[model samples]
Target: MTQTHPTFAEKLIAWQKQHGRHNLAWQVSDPYQIWLSEIMLQQTQVVTVSEYFPRFIEKFPTVQDLANAEQDEVLALWQGLGYYSRARNLHFAAQQICHDFGGVFPENRESLQQLKGVGRSTAAAIAAFAFGKRETILDGNVKRILCRIFALDGEGKAFENQLWDFAEILLPENSSEMSAYTQGLMDLGATVCQRKPNCAICPMADICQAKQQDRIAELPRKKSVKVQEMTLYWLILRDKNRIFLQKRPQKGIWAGLYCVPCFENGADFHNYLRDKQMDFDDLHECATISHRLTHRVLEIIPYECDCKNAAFSANFNENDGIWVDLTDLPQYGLPKPLQQYLA
Candidate 1:
């Protein structure tokens, strides 16, 4: 509760039983669903993920189903969820679990951690939520809470591990309530002990170290990195009333999502479009969108082309591009840039 006082886990967990996210759709006995939700939640907001979670579970209800699914299909289901690697890794991990763990998700923390993309926080989440293991969690929320509560500063990759150790120390011996404790600590940071925290309702309000020091806003941060720069040219060619959409390859970024044929600045995007087999009479460059990635910033230059002298009966290659009906755009998941062009 304080820099001097100890063991805040019990109080947080106790508060959690009465005031946490209990009605979330993923709180159940199924390990696959819990694991999938945790994977999806990494660096993704719960509000965005909430819409996809139920649909995902309904589509691939079991680990084997997910494992057996085409990589593109999985990526399609995870379109717009960003951090595409999570979907890829989830598929790889499911296969491993099926082959090695009898088509069942591992129950304990150690085994779960061995699965692909199952890092410490994720492993602890699956263990605690599914098997009620008392493994402590130190996700982004917990790290922020701990860093502020201790008035801690400086970036340490090992800081989360250290915080987990502290969390374990603070955990009650009864240990029957890990699910509540883990979720509660996260929710407290999310709702009460927030970035601009409303400390009045915080269970640790009277004793939080950052509050005592009057430095709540600047407790947890790392040195900032340089943002990468990218420039893209998007060719949104349309025939009749259908706009062009291409399926990205299954390996790179936006894999399995639809896009207008695009190229980065270093590459010849105009030349690439010229090589395409389309009957276009006009090309107009629309305004650009500044697209940001975790490591790079992209300037998307959209070009609108009106096709003529072409029937709606030609097929093309090197161009996975299709003429999708604008009215039915939502039926297929296009990459964000295409969706933005439509918008």
Candidate 2:
């Protein structure tokens, strides 16, 4: 008799049972925690999410608790986590669940996808892990895994559609195995099938088409990303123990966060000061800082000034800026670099 081997899903499920991450904080069968973890994991590392997840759950243990909380509180708790939009969406989705889903998480992928920030892969993961539904997840890690396993070479919607189809086809026949199989794909990609994959230790090494074809490095094609650079000038006005901060606009980078007044350049800052007829001859240029975002690098230049005895209360009121006590600065949501600078 010819030797028989387990199918891809069987091998993955077996590997996951023995070696996958089971002690993760969000591994429980709670949809709320699973959903929150999935959203946080997008474009972020597992280690980072692990740190944030516990604090978030501690603050809002239930979806209703999250829904009732203020946006500022949510954003403040989500501080230091880049991509503030995810925090916003998670809050919004909680409200949606309470109002639309009757405070219960949707049981299936399609209904779950209706939640803001919950995409197809996220919905599938939530459904599988929380409800033991037969679903497939094709997140970045799973996409890379699929691309390498099948020796796929393409990019754009067509390539993504192919991956999605493959993802659906690769689902284990038994619904009970969905959770382990899904986690297996994530664990395999994150640990073994990385950019520089460790093929020797990979359970799917024998079956991976890329390994057989000697194209593991070339299987998953990625587009080149150019990181743009920008310069921002911040005015740090301090009066005694209080520092001035303005709420950033609701759109663009660092949206809905509190920061010192920012300008595009020195000329802009000078023009703004002139327009407001505010002059402080004691303005001192502070050290410049560079903050790197996913697609852009910001060079921040800060100008500090002591505004003691200068009554700019009326001016600040008109500009929606507030003087916050240094001791109470932790109450507000601030950009990571600004938080570091202030610290």
Prediction RMSDs, each to the true structure: 2.9, 2.9
For each candidate in turn, the TM-score is 0.88, 0.94
Encode model 1's per-residue lDDT on 138-242: one tens digit a residue: 787887888778776766667655666766776556657777887887789778876678888888877688889987888788557799887878777677777
Q: Whole-model lDDT for model 1 versus the true structure?
A: 0.78
Clashing pairs in 2: none
lDDT of 2 at 188: 97
- Backbone clashes in each candidate structure, one number apiece? 0, 0
Segments of candidate 2 deviating more than 4 angstroms: 1-6, 265-267, 310-314
Q: Write the per-residue lDDT of candidate 2 for residues 1-343, one digit (tens) a residue.
A: 1112349899999999998989999999999999999999998899999999999999999999999999889989989888998998999999999999999999999999999988898999999999999888887788888878877788999878877776777788898898899899899989999989999899998898889998887878887999999999988888889888998887898888889999877788988787766774757988999999999999998888777666664466635588899999878999999899989
lDDT of 2 at 340: 98
Which residue runs of candidate 1 sit more than 4 Å off their true CA positions? 1-4, 158-160, 250-252, 274-281, 311-315, 318-331
